[model samples]
Structures are given as C-alpha cells and as structure tokens.
Target: MANTPGAKKAARKIARRTEVNKARRSRVRTYLRRFEEALSAGDAAAAKTAFVEAQSELMRAVSKGVVHKNTGARKVSRLAAALKKLGGSAA
Candidate 1:
C-alpha cells in the first residue's frame, strides 16, 4: 500500500522497470536455449552460429544493464567450451 504520492509513483516506476527487465531476461534465455539446442544436436556449424548470435545478444543485454558482465562472460565461456567439446567428442 502506497500512501504518499511519491510512494505511488515509485511503485509505478518499479512495475514499469520489472516489465522491461522481464522481457530482456526472456530474450536472453531464448538465445541461450537456441545455442543449447544446437549444441545438443551436435551440429558444430549451427552451434557456432548460434553461439555468435547469442554472444552478441548477451553483450547487448550487459550493455543495457539487463545482465551482469561477468555473468554474460561465464555463459559465453561455457557455451563455447561445450561447443568445442562437441567437436572433440565427434572426432
């Protein structure tokens, strides 16, 4: 319950930011899932492609303050490692 006018405005701002962040989060997840699926399918070409796109999207999210820089770096690192291992196992 927001009794004061400023408190009500703050609540509204929070709601708006939540919606924006939710969309950003969902977008990042979708990109990550695409990369995972490509990796699971053992398609190096597709996985690499997906990885590049996902990396770009992740960095964008980081620049927009939607995700932390270290978080994005870790995600990209893990995905790249998985992709590399996928090729190694196939060889």
Candidate 2:
C-alpha cells in the first residue's frame, strides 16, 4: 500500500519495470531454448547459429541489467562447451 504520492509513483514504476524485465527474461529463455533444441537435435550447424544468437541475446540481457553478469557469463560458457563438444568452434 502506497500512502504517499511519491510512493505510489514508485510502485507504478516498479510494476512497469517488472513487466519489462519479465518479458526480457522470457525472450532470453526463448533464445536459449532455440540453442538447446538445435543441440539436442544434433544439428551442429544450426546449433552453432543458434548459439551465436543466444550468446548475443544473453550478453544484451546482462548489459540491460535483466540478468547478473556472472550468471550470463556462466551460461555463455556452458553453451560454448556444448558447442565445442559438437565439434564446432565457439567463437
């Protein structure tokens, strides 16, 4: 409950930010899922492409503060490992 005008405004801002962050997270997940699907399907070429795009999306999310820096780095590392296992160079 926001009793003051400033508090009410802050609450509204928080709500909007929450929605935006939620959408950003969901979009990041979608990009990761694309890479996962390609990896699981054993399509090295497709997985490589998806991994590149997902890496970009993940780093963007980190830059936007939607995700922590270390978390994003770890995710990128794991995906790169998986890509490497698929006989592709994770550039």
Candidate 3:
C-alpha cells in the first residue's frame, strides 16, 4: 500500500518501467530464439543474420539497463561460439 503521494507516484513509475523492461526482455528473447532456430535449421546465412540481430538487441537491452553488461557480453559470446560451431563466421 502506497500511503504517501510520493510513494504512490513511485509505484506508478515502477509499474511503467516494469512493463517497458518486460517488453525489452521479450524482444531480446525473441531475437535469441530466432538465432537458435536458424542455427538448428543449419541455415548459415539466416543464422548469421539472426546472430547479428540478437547481439544488437541484447546490447541495446544492456545499454537500457534491462540486462547487466557482463551478462549481455557473455550471452553474445556464447551465441558467437555456437554460430562458429555451426560453421558460420560471427564477424
């Protein structure tokens, strides 16, 4: 219960931020899923494209504070490794 006016406003702000963050997280996940699907399908070109998009989205999320910097880097690294293992150069 937010009794104080400031507290109520803070709660509202938090709710709005939560929604935005959730959307950003979902977007990142969607990009990641696309990359995974491309990889699994063994489409080198599509996988490369998806990897770039996923890495971009992840970095954007990290910059927006939706994800930690190290975490984002780690995920990108793993994705690159997977792409490499799939015979694609993650340039």
Candidate 4:
C-alpha cells in the first residue's frame, strides 16, 4: 500500500529489519531457555556455562539495539541471581 517509490523502499527496509530483529530475539530466547534447562537440571556447572553464554548474547542484543539497555541488564541480573542460588559464580 505504498504510494511513493520512497515509501516502497522504506517498507522493504522495514521488512528486512523486522526479519533480522526476529532472528535476534529468537536467538536470545534460545540461549535463555538453555540456561533455564541447565538450572532445572540442578547442574551448577552447566548452568554457569549457559548463563555466561546467555548473558553474552543478551548484552550483544542490547548493543545491537534489539533490546533495551535496562532490560538486558535486568535479565542478566535475574539470571545471575538464579545462578548464584544454584551455587554458581556469576563469572
């Protein structure tokens, strides 16, 4: 429904960006789910490893503007807390 050429190009750009963002979001969720699974399995070592990876991915998302800075920080904080409760270090 774009009337102008510029509008059509903008729509295409938006569609591409949306696809990229969705992929990024799904990647983050996959990492988070892995972390949660490790936690539920009662494997401190595995959970720590997953937490590290998930935290890195989350921060990367924030840097890419896919996630808000505060939101990423909050998710990391909560995950760290859960990791700690599992007798794992936040490192």
Candidate 4 vs. truth: CA RMSD? 0.6
Q: Tens digits of per-residue lDDT for model 3 on 1-91? A: 9999999999999999999999999999999999999999999999999999999999999999999999999999999999999999999
Tens digits of per-residue lDDT, candidate 4, 1-91, equal 9999999999999999999999999999999999999999999999999999999999999999999999999999999999999899996
TM-score of each: 0.89, 0.98, 0.99, 0.97
Clashing pairs in 1: none
Clashing pairs in 2: none
Candidate 3 global lDDT: 0.99
Q: At residue 22, give the lDDT of candidate 2.
A: 96
**Models sorted by lDDT, best on top:** 3, 4, 2, 1
lDDT of every predicted structure (CA atoms):
0.86, 0.97, 0.99, 0.98
Q: Model 2, range 1-91, lDDT digits (tens) per residue?
A: 9999999999999999999999999999999999999999999999999999999999999999999999999999999999999988898
Cα lDDT for residue 21, model 2? Answer: 95
Residues 1-91, candidate 1: write the lDDT tens digits: 9999999999999999999989998999999999889988878888888888898899999998999999988987887788888883221
Span of 10 residues, lowest total lDDT, candidate 1: 82-91
Q: Global lDDT for candidate 2?
A: 0.97
What's model 3's TM-score? Answer: 0.99
Q: What lDDT score goes with residue 84 in model 1?
A: 80
